[model samples]
Target: MTTLRALTPADASGIRRIYSGAAVTYLMRPEMTASEAEAYVARVIEWSRAAPVAQYVLGVDVAGDLVGVVKLGRRPAGHGRVSYVLREDVWGRGYATAAVERLAAYAFTAAALESLGAKHHPDNPASGRVLTKAGFTCLGADGGFVHYWLDRDGRRESSGQHREGPGVSPGRTRCPRGRSSR
Candidate 1:
Protein backbone atom coordinates (compact mmCIF):
# COMPACT_ATOMS: atom_id res chain seq x y z
CA MET A 1 0.00 0.00 0.00
CA THR A 2 1.06 3.58 -0.60
CA THR A 3 1.38 6.01 2.29
CA LEU A 4 2.08 9.71 2.88
CA ARG A 5 4.06 10.85 5.85
CA ALA A 6 5.48 14.12 7.12
CA LEU A 7 8.94 14.52 5.63
CA THR A 8 11.99 13.93 7.80
CA PRO A 9 15.66 14.71 7.48
CA ALA A 10 16.30 11.00 7.06
CA ASP A 11 14.66 10.94 3.63
CA ALA A 12 17.44 12.94 2.03
CA SER A 13 19.28 9.85 0.92
CA GLY A 14 16.34 8.41 -1.00
CA ILE A 15 15.47 11.71 -2.62
CA ARG A 16 19.09 12.30 -3.57
CA ARG A 17 19.17 8.96 -5.27
CA ILE A 18 15.98 9.67 -7.22
CA TYR A 19 16.89 13.13 -8.54
CA SER A 20 19.50 12.06 -10.99
CA GLY A 21 19.96 11.40 -14.73
CA ALA A 22 18.66 13.26 -17.78
CA ALA A 23 14.99 12.30 -17.49
CA VAL A 24 14.43 13.37 -13.89
CA THR A 25 16.80 16.28 -14.39
CA TYR A 26 14.41 17.58 -17.05
CA LEU A 27 11.65 17.81 -14.43
CA MET A 28 13.52 18.42 -11.18
CA ARG A 29 16.05 21.26 -11.39
CA PRO A 30 19.53 21.94 -10.11
CA GLU A 31 20.33 18.30 -9.43
CA MET A 32 21.63 17.97 -5.93
CA THR A 33 24.43 15.93 -4.46
CA ALA A 34 23.71 13.55 -1.57
CA SER A 35 25.04 16.10 0.90
CA GLU A 36 22.94 18.83 -0.64
CA ALA A 37 19.80 16.73 -0.39
CA GLU A 38 20.54 16.15 3.28
CA ALA A 39 20.87 19.87 3.81
CA TYR A 40 17.60 20.47 2.01
CA VAL A 41 15.83 17.97 4.22
CA ALA A 42 17.26 19.63 7.29
CA ARG A 43 15.87 22.93 6.11
CA VAL A 44 12.46 21.40 5.52
CA ILE A 45 12.34 19.86 8.99
CA GLU A 46 13.36 23.09 10.61
CA TRP A 47 10.79 25.12 8.75
CA SER A 48 7.98 22.64 9.43
CA ARG A 49 8.74 22.66 13.16
CA ALA A 50 8.09 26.36 13.10
CA ALA A 51 4.40 26.97 13.89
CA PRO A 52 2.00 28.69 11.47
CA VAL A 53 4.04 27.50 8.57
CA ALA A 54 2.48 27.82 5.11
CA GLN A 55 4.15 25.08 3.08
CA TYR A 56 3.48 21.39 3.71
CA VAL A 57 5.74 18.63 2.36
CA LEU A 58 5.22 14.91 2.78
CA GLY A 59 7.20 11.85 1.93
CA VAL A 60 5.56 9.12 -0.13
CA ASP A 61 6.24 5.61 0.99
CA VAL A 62 5.26 2.13 -0.11
CA ALA A 63 5.54 -0.87 2.19
CA GLY A 64 7.81 1.09 4.52
CA ASP A 65 10.23 2.29 1.84
CA LEU A 66 10.61 5.93 0.96
CA VAL A 67 9.64 6.49 -2.66
CA GLY A 68 8.70 10.13 -3.22
CA VAL A 69 7.58 13.49 -1.83
CA VAL A 70 4.65 15.86 -2.23
CA LYS A 71 4.52 19.54 -1.40
CA LEU A 72 1.72 22.05 -1.05
CA GLY A 73 3.53 25.31 -1.27
CA ARG A 74 1.98 28.65 -0.46
CA ARG A 75 1.04 30.93 -3.31
CA PRO A 76 0.54 34.68 -3.26
CA ALA A 77 -3.20 34.19 -3.86
CA GLY A 78 -3.86 32.41 -0.59
CA HIS A 79 -3.87 29.07 -2.38
CA GLY A 80 -1.18 26.49 -2.97
CA ARG A 81 1.14 25.21 -5.70
CA VAL A 82 1.50 21.44 -5.71
CA SER A 83 4.75 19.63 -6.46
CA TYR A 84 5.86 16.04 -6.11
CA VAL A 85 8.74 13.74 -7.02
CA LEU A 86 9.13 9.98 -7.07
CA ARG A 87 11.97 7.51 -7.02
CA GLU A 88 12.92 6.89 -10.66
CA ASP A 89 12.91 3.13 -10.11
CA VAL A 90 9.24 3.22 -9.08
CA TRP A 91 7.84 5.12 -12.03
CA GLY A 92 4.69 4.11 -14.03
CA ARG A 93 2.97 2.37 -11.09
CA GLY A 94 0.34 5.04 -10.32
CA TYR A 95 2.04 6.08 -7.08
CA ALA A 96 2.55 9.61 -8.39
CA THR A 97 -1.09 9.94 -9.32
CA ALA A 98 -2.24 8.60 -5.96
CA ALA A 99 0.08 10.83 -3.98
CA VAL A 100 -0.91 14.00 -5.85
CA GLU A 101 -4.60 13.19 -5.56
CA ARG A 102 -4.32 12.77 -1.82
CA LEU A 103 -2.34 15.97 -1.53
CA ALA A 104 -4.86 17.92 -3.61
CA ALA A 105 -7.67 16.94 -1.26
CA TYR A 106 -5.54 17.74 1.76
CA ALA A 107 -4.63 21.15 0.37
CA PHE A 108 -8.28 22.06 -0.20
CA THR A 109 -9.00 21.24 3.43
CA ALA A 110 -6.11 21.37 5.93
CA ALA A 111 -4.87 24.63 4.47
CA ALA A 112 -8.38 25.95 3.88
CA LEU A 113 -7.21 26.62 0.36
CA GLU A 114 -9.49 27.47 -2.54
CA SER A 115 -7.20 26.31 -5.35
CA LEU A 116 -4.01 24.40 -6.00
CA GLY A 117 -1.79 24.79 -9.04
CA ALA A 118 0.89 22.61 -10.58
CA LYS A 119 3.28 22.81 -13.47
CA HIS A 120 5.31 20.35 -15.50
CA HIS A 121 7.81 20.62 -18.28
CA PRO A 122 5.83 20.51 -21.52
CA ASP A 123 8.01 17.69 -22.74
CA ASN A 124 7.22 15.67 -19.64
CA PRO A 125 3.74 14.46 -20.49
CA ALA A 126 4.02 11.81 -17.80
CA SER A 127 4.05 14.49 -15.12
CA GLY A 128 1.14 16.17 -16.80
CA ARG A 129 -0.78 12.87 -16.89
CA VAL A 130 -0.27 12.42 -13.18
CA LEU A 131 -1.75 15.85 -12.54
CA THR A 132 -4.62 15.23 -14.91
CA LYS A 133 -5.48 11.96 -13.17
CA ALA A 134 -5.46 13.85 -9.91
CA GLY A 135 -8.06 16.31 -11.27
CA PHE A 136 -5.92 19.14 -12.59
CA THR A 137 -6.47 20.60 -16.04
CA CYS A 138 -4.23 22.55 -18.36
CA LEU A 139 -3.84 26.29 -17.83
CA GLY A 140 -1.32 26.92 -20.58
CA ALA A 141 2.39 27.52 -20.24
CA ASP A 142 4.06 29.74 -17.69
CA GLY A 143 7.69 30.15 -16.68
CA GLY A 144 8.77 27.41 -19.06
CA PHE A 145 6.29 24.82 -17.76
CA VAL A 146 2.72 23.89 -18.53
CA HIS A 147 0.50 24.82 -15.62
CA TYR A 148 -2.57 23.08 -14.17
CA TRP A 149 -5.14 23.89 -11.54
CA LEU A 150 -7.72 22.18 -9.32
CA ASP A 151 -10.26 24.27 -7.52
CA ARG A 152 -12.46 23.25 -4.62
CA ASP A 153 -15.65 23.15 -6.66
CA GLY A 154 -13.98 21.47 -9.64
CA ARG A 155 -12.95 18.62 -7.38
CA ARG A 156 -16.49 18.29 -6.07
CA GLU A 157 -18.12 18.55 -9.49
CA SER A 158 -16.37 15.54 -10.91
CA SER A 159 -18.55 12.75 -12.37
CA GLY A 160 -16.55 10.24 -10.42
CA GLN A 161 -18.06 9.44 -7.00
CA HIS A 162 -16.50 11.25 -4.09
CA ARG A 163 -17.27 11.56 -0.36
CA GLU A 164 -15.20 14.53 0.78
CA GLY A 165 -17.07 17.80 1.00
CA PRO A 166 -15.79 21.36 1.34
CA GLY A 167 -14.32 20.34 4.67
CA VAL A 168 -13.15 16.94 3.44
CA SER A 169 -9.52 17.36 2.46
CA PRO A 170 -7.30 14.27 2.32
CA GLY A 171 -3.85 13.54 3.86
CA ARG A 172 -4.56 15.58 6.95
CA THR A 173 -7.78 14.99 8.86
CA ARG A 174 -8.77 12.06 6.66
CA CYS A 175 -5.34 10.49 6.99
CA PRO A 176 -4.73 8.91 10.37
CA ARG A 177 -1.17 8.67 11.62
CA GLY A 178 0.45 9.33 8.24
CA ARG A 179 -1.30 6.44 6.55
CA SER A 180 -2.59 6.45 2.96
CA SER A 181 -6.19 7.58 2.98
CA ARG A 182 -6.34 6.81 -0.77
Candidate 2:
Protein backbone atom coordinates (compact mmCIF):
# COMPACT_ATOMS: atom_id res chain seq x y z
CA MET A 1 0.00 0.00 0.00
CA THR A 2 1.08 3.57 -0.67
CA THR A 3 0.20 6.62 1.43
CA LEU A 4 1.02 10.32 1.28
CA ARG A 5 1.51 12.20 4.53
CA ALA A 6 3.14 15.24 6.04
CA LEU A 7 6.89 14.90 6.34
CA THR A 8 8.15 14.44 9.86
CA PRO A 9 11.61 15.05 11.22
CA ALA A 10 12.00 11.29 11.38
CA ASP A 11 11.74 11.10 7.64
CA ALA A 12 14.98 12.95 7.05
CA SER A 13 17.17 9.87 6.87
CA GLY A 14 15.00 8.03 4.37
CA ILE A 15 14.71 11.22 2.39
CA ARG A 16 18.46 11.52 2.51
CA ARG A 17 18.82 8.06 1.04
CA ILE A 18 16.43 8.91 -1.76
CA TYR A 19 18.20 12.14 -2.65
CA SER A 20 21.70 10.75 -2.33
CA GLY A 21 21.42 8.42 -5.28
CA ALA A 22 22.91 9.51 -8.61
CA ALA A 23 20.41 7.34 -10.44
CA VAL A 24 17.52 9.10 -8.76
CA THR A 25 18.95 12.61 -8.88
CA TYR A 26 20.27 12.42 -12.45
CA LEU A 27 17.23 14.15 -13.91
CA MET A 28 16.33 16.00 -10.74
CA ARG A 29 19.11 17.74 -8.88
CA PRO A 30 22.56 17.00 -7.64
CA GLU A 31 22.84 14.21 -5.10
CA MET A 32 22.20 15.59 -1.64
CA THR A 33 24.27 14.83 1.39
CA ALA A 34 22.68 13.72 4.64
CA SER A 35 22.87 17.21 6.08
CA GLU A 36 21.40 18.74 2.96
CA ALA A 37 18.50 16.30 2.96
CA GLU A 38 17.82 17.10 6.60
CA ALA A 39 17.81 20.78 5.80
CA TYR A 40 15.50 20.20 2.86
CA VAL A 41 13.04 18.28 5.05
CA ALA A 42 13.17 21.09 7.56
CA ARG A 43 12.31 23.60 4.87
CA VAL A 44 9.46 21.46 3.65
CA ILE A 45 8.04 21.16 7.15
CA GLU A 46 8.17 24.92 7.52
CA TRP A 47 6.43 25.37 4.17
CA SER A 48 3.61 23.10 5.35
CA ARG A 49 3.07 25.41 8.30
CA ALA A 50 2.92 28.61 6.34
CA ALA A 51 -0.30 30.58 5.97
CA PRO A 52 -2.03 29.75 2.66
CA VAL A 53 0.53 27.06 2.11
CA ALA A 54 2.16 27.32 -1.30
CA GLN A 55 3.84 23.94 -1.36
CA TYR A 56 3.17 20.40 -0.23
CA VAL A 57 6.22 18.16 0.25
CA LEU A 58 4.56 14.96 1.21
CA GLY A 59 6.51 11.83 2.02
CA VAL A 60 5.62 8.84 -0.12
CA ASP A 61 5.11 5.87 2.16
CA VAL A 62 5.05 2.40 0.69
CA ALA A 63 3.77 -0.21 3.11
CA GLY A 64 5.37 1.52 6.11
CA ASP A 65 8.67 2.78 4.70
CA LEU A 66 9.30 6.23 3.34
CA VAL A 67 10.23 5.49 -0.25
CA GLY A 68 9.88 8.83 -2.01
CA VAL A 69 8.25 12.28 -2.05
CA VAL A 70 5.57 13.87 -4.19
CA LYS A 71 5.28 17.63 -4.29
CA LEU A 72 2.46 19.90 -5.40
CA GLY A 73 3.21 23.58 -5.84
CA ARG A 74 0.32 25.96 -6.32
CA ARG A 75 0.63 28.33 -9.22
CA PRO A 76 -1.22 31.47 -10.22
CA ALA A 77 -4.81 31.28 -11.57
CA GLY A 78 -5.83 28.05 -9.87
CA HIS A 79 -3.18 26.00 -11.56
CA GLY A 80 -0.46 23.99 -9.86
CA ARG A 81 2.60 21.90 -10.69
CA VAL A 82 3.39 18.38 -9.46
CA SER A 83 6.60 16.43 -9.31
CA TYR A 84 8.13 13.48 -7.50
CA VAL A 85 11.24 11.39 -6.85
CA LEU A 86 11.51 7.82 -5.59
CA ARG A 87 14.24 5.49 -4.43
CA GLU A 88 15.94 3.75 -7.35
CA ASP A 89 15.04 0.41 -5.85
CA VAL A 90 11.37 1.25 -6.24
CA TRP A 91 11.69 2.14 -9.90
CA GLY A 92 9.60 0.16 -12.47
CA ARG A 93 6.88 -0.39 -9.90
CA GLY A 94 3.63 1.60 -10.16
CA TYR A 95 4.26 3.62 -7.02
CA ALA A 96 5.04 6.82 -8.89
CA THR A 97 1.91 6.52 -10.98
CA ALA A 98 -0.25 5.78 -7.93
CA ALA A 99 1.26 8.63 -5.97
CA VAL A 100 0.67 11.05 -8.84
CA GLU A 101 -2.91 9.91 -9.21
CA ARG A 102 -3.62 10.48 -5.53
CA LEU A 103 -1.95 13.87 -5.56
CA ALA A 104 -3.97 14.99 -8.59
CA ALA A 105 -7.17 13.94 -6.86
CA TYR A 106 -6.27 16.03 -3.84
CA ALA A 107 -5.31 18.97 -6.03
CA PHE A 108 -8.60 18.98 -7.84
CA THR A 109 -10.92 18.04 -4.96
CA ALA A 110 -9.35 19.50 -1.83
CA ALA A 111 -7.01 22.22 -2.98
CA ALA A 112 -9.66 23.30 -5.47
CA LEU A 113 -7.09 23.62 -8.21
CA GLU A 114 -8.34 23.98 -11.79
CA SER A 115 -5.32 22.39 -13.42
CA LEU A 116 -1.91 20.89 -12.81
CA GLY A 117 1.24 20.91 -14.92
CA ALA A 118 4.37 18.80 -14.94
CA LYS A 119 7.55 18.39 -16.93
CA HIS A 120 10.23 15.74 -17.21
CA HIS A 121 13.67 15.56 -18.72
CA PRO A 122 13.49 14.07 -22.19
CA ASP A 123 16.04 11.46 -21.25
CA ASN A 124 13.69 10.23 -18.57
CA PRO A 125 10.91 8.68 -20.60
CA ALA A 126 9.80 6.64 -17.57
CA SER A 127 8.77 9.83 -15.85
CA GLY A 128 6.70 10.76 -18.87
CA ARG A 129 4.95 7.40 -18.73
CA VAL A 130 4.11 7.94 -15.10
CA LEU A 131 2.57 11.34 -15.87
CA THR A 132 0.57 9.93 -18.76
CA LYS A 133 -0.73 7.04 -16.65
CA ALA A 134 -1.85 9.59 -14.07
CA GLY A 135 -4.03 11.35 -16.65
CA PHE A 136 -1.85 14.24 -17.80
CA THR A 137 -1.98 15.00 -21.52
CA CYS A 138 1.26 15.68 -23.31
CA LEU A 139 1.86 19.36 -24.11
CA GLY A 140 4.96 18.65 -26.20
CA ALA A 141 8.56 19.45 -25.44
CA ASP A 142 9.74 22.84 -24.25
CA GLY A 143 12.82 24.19 -22.55
CA GLY A 144 14.51 20.78 -22.78
CA PHE A 145 11.68 18.95 -21.02
CA VAL A 146 8.50 17.26 -22.15
CA HIS A 147 5.61 19.18 -20.59
CA TYR A 148 2.26 17.80 -19.52
CA TRP A 149 -1.03 19.17 -18.20
CA LEU A 150 -4.10 17.91 -16.38
CA ASP A 151 -7.09 20.18 -15.80
CA ARG A 152 -9.96 19.42 -13.43
CA ASP A 153 -12.30 18.41 -16.23
CA GLY A 154 -9.59 16.48 -17.99
CA ARG A 155 -8.76 14.58 -14.85
CA ARG A 156 -12.40 13.76 -14.36
CA GLU A 157 -12.79 12.65 -17.93
CA SER A 158 -9.74 10.38 -17.83
CA SER A 159 -10.36 9.02 -14.34
CA GLY A 160 -13.59 7.28 -15.11
CA GLN A 161 -12.21 4.06 -13.65
CA HIS A 162 -10.07 5.53 -10.92
CA ARG A 163 -10.07 3.64 -7.64
CA GLU A 164 -8.41 4.57 -4.40
CA GLY A 165 -5.61 2.23 -3.45
CA PRO A 166 -5.99 0.43 -0.16
CA GLY A 167 -4.58 2.46 2.73
CA VAL A 168 -4.04 5.52 0.55
CA SER A 169 -3.86 8.73 2.57
CA PRO A 170 -3.88 12.17 0.93
CA GLY A 171 -2.54 14.95 3.10
CA ARG A 172 -4.81 17.85 4.02
CA THR A 173 -3.54 21.39 3.38
CA ARG A 174 -3.54 24.10 0.76
CA CYS A 175 -0.55 24.46 -1.59
CA PRO A 176 1.32 27.52 -2.82
CA ARG A 177 3.17 28.72 -5.89
CA GLY A 178 6.84 27.80 -6.15
CA ARG A 179 9.40 25.86 -8.16
CA SER A 180 9.70 22.14 -7.46
CA SER A 181 13.13 20.53 -7.07
CA ARG A 182 12.23 17.42 -9.08
The best candidate by lDDT is 2
Q: All candidates' TM-scores?
A: 0.79, 0.83
lDDT over C-alpha atoms for residue 62 of model 1: 90
How many residue pairs clash in model 1?
2
Minimum summed lDDT over a 10-residue window in model 2 is located at: 172-181
Clashes of 2: 4
Candidate 1, 117-139: lDDT as tens digits: 77776677788788878887555
TM-score, cand. 1 vs. native: 0.79
lDDT of 2 by residue, 1-182 (tens): 88999998888899988886655654556887888888999999999999888998898899899989999999888888898999998998899999999999999998899888887776777888888888876555555666667778865323322222111123311111121112
Highest TM-score scorer: 2
Model 1 misplacement above 4 A: 28-30, 155-182
Give candidate 2 regions above 4 Å deviation: 155-182
- lDDT score of residue 20 within candidate 2: 63
Write down the lDDT of every candidate, Cα atoms only: 0.72, 0.76
